[model samples]
Target: MTTDRADDRNVAVVTPWYPNPQQEWAGAFVQAMVEATAPGCDEVTVYHNEAWLMRQAPEEVEAAREAHRRLLPVALHDAPTVAGARLMRLPVPTVPDYTFAELAQQHASWLRESLGGEPIPARVVHAHVGLRGGWTALENARPDARVFVTEHASFIDKVLEQPDSRDMYEQVLDRCTGFFAVTDVLRDRLAETFPALAHKIELISNPISFEAPRPRPVTELRRWLYVGTLVERKGVGWLLEAFAECHAGDPELTLTIAGPGVLAGALAKRAAELHVDHVVTFTGEVAPDEATRLMREHDLLVHPARWETFGVSIIEAVAAGMPVLVTRCGGPERTLAGIEDAVGEMIDVEENSESIVAGYHRLRDRFPDGLDLAKGRRVLDERFGYRTVAQAHYRHWFSGPEAGEGAASGGEEA
Candidate 1:
């Protein structure tokens, strides 16, 4: 972290979510951003601040905190740096159910403790979420460092509704050098939430890397894939019902549910209840690379999430050269705006499977001729490809020296 390095090439990423042994699917886009932006920079370090909540009784909380304070030093001594960046895993032990503002304070305090009360030794710091990550960066970043935050949490509405959390978020918005949202839906939500700070927010899409040509183009839409957490919010139940209906007509049709969540067993039982368990496969959580491979093997990606701030999986599927049948959740509508007909179908979000079944039929009728997978892939690549996203980040972070130095006074135009 020497100043002799190229200007604005030394960057630090502070994030509450990251791929770890406990949750491999968490904060994958944050890792992608680090990997994509790291190549162009001289150095990148990621400080992953994760909470290790204690389930002990109220009377034992103090003892647990003391034990954690003693054990953390030994734990961090042999921590490994993974992937393309120098990773520092900062695990904070605490009780669960704290409000967002209180939780952010704990996260920031842990980061400062890890650094021995010293400021983060980087010129630019980018955090994944506003509350804990952005607030952590703002608290620890050097006086001259340019700090930025990207809002990507699906539970952001809950976080902002609380008075304490909203006040803390406003402070974070006021202090950071710049802020970005992954999609127009998220940007609009943030803008409307704080109209005075609306001008400071902008768009920065998640990056995707295109793979080699598929061995063969999809001639038929038989194999369906869903790659995400198996949660109620993801509409996994609706997806399962729709799959059963589709499979009844076409016995050859199959569905694969990837990723892990609390609803795995319930979804499995529901599949059996629908009598489609034999045709469905549940492969629990997978590494990011394996998720990509799954996309390559399947003909279509079916993401039936009730909502999304930014649907990274939908873009990843398209990059893998697979068409998608996703819900018109907030993200997919904006991400697939003009290319709806070219990619696949965009059905409305619903509790029942009727929309999904009808959309599947409509997409099936279009088949190979009516759809243009290549055009969809090209369009998304130009927008979300690694090169495109990394450059956009650099332009905002290092376009001028004034931007880096004016953190307290509000930096140069983004």
Candidate 2:
């Protein structure tokens, strides 16, 4: 499938977070998608979330500026420009951030101004998430500009957790052009709420860069690793409980957790209560290299997330040829299908000691000597590898609107 329109088609890829050297998996897939899609098109440009820009340190900020300079083709826009191929970063004010509603409104105004007098000839405006950047795209992109939104996780879920933001979420969803849920579970839930856009929805799993599986030497002590935000939804509490049960029987077992969130103190307390604090290590947030090193060293990767749209870490572990024990939540279940034996096991999200112990026993029984790293690696390469997924996306991109219609058929309710 090809488009003569391809040469004229200018795409603006927008995201709220982007991975840097300091924070590896923080929107790392966005970086991969832009790099992959940009080269194939006549022009591809990227826009960053200015709200997040304020949180970085001076050096990190400078590093991001330099990265954009080297990688992206266009510049940040004071106002939108009319060009055949251009990447324009929408300038958002650093203050008066009252709420998500306010922020979206501010962004909508900025997007309108960015386009200025120029008509947006954009065939597609691909947004990384549905709420923030996606809302802005829906608001300002030319009516004909198809808006595609990828829901990485439940930003709405996060908002609903706070008593103040529930109404604001409804507004955000209403403005989305088409929704992309990372997992079937998320898609179903969204479909229940917005049946009108249900047919417009699609399932797009996050992609991983497949590497030749490097098997690590069988470690003397079986190490387990968990990487993600140290938050409630990640099921850190459940993981701690499960780890405690598993470690009680096997005193030599060790666990390492990476990433930062507000639940750090609560998780620490839970660990102490379970009396597994001695064996558990929390590294807060670490560099990507360090996270990968820990994954390689570990015998199994445990992700007891209560809810996940897609667990990129599970894919990363599979790519690294390590087994993963994930909850039968959103993302992990989708990724673990078919390759259940070699990669890892999925436990119930109950986060009980029995469930955790059972999950461990399941892993031990399936690969009593430990998983075949080679087999695990092969699974990831065939299914989740970036090149394969990228090709799928490229087909979707140039194939035009009807492609999405066919892809949307037989779509399960999530």
TM per candidate comes to: 0.94, 0.76
In candidate 2, which residue ranges exceed 4 Å CA deviation?
1-6, 20-24, 52-99, 112-122, 142-144, 157-178, 215-221, 269-278, 368-373, 401-414
Residue 153 CA displacement from its true place in model 1, Å? 0.8
Q: Can you write out model 2's per-residue Cα lDDT over 247-294, one digit (the tens) per residue?
A: 878898888988888988888888888888888899898765567777
The best candidate by TM-score is 1
RMSD of candidates 1 onward, in order? 3.6, 7.6
In model 1, the runs with Cα more than 4 Å from the true position are 1-7, 77-83, 403-414
Residue 123 of model 1 has an lDDT of: 84
- Ten contiguous residues with the weakest lDDT in model 2: 405-414
Candidate 1 residue-wise lDDT, 205-284, digit = tens: 88887755577788789999999998889998899999999999999999999989999999999999989899899999
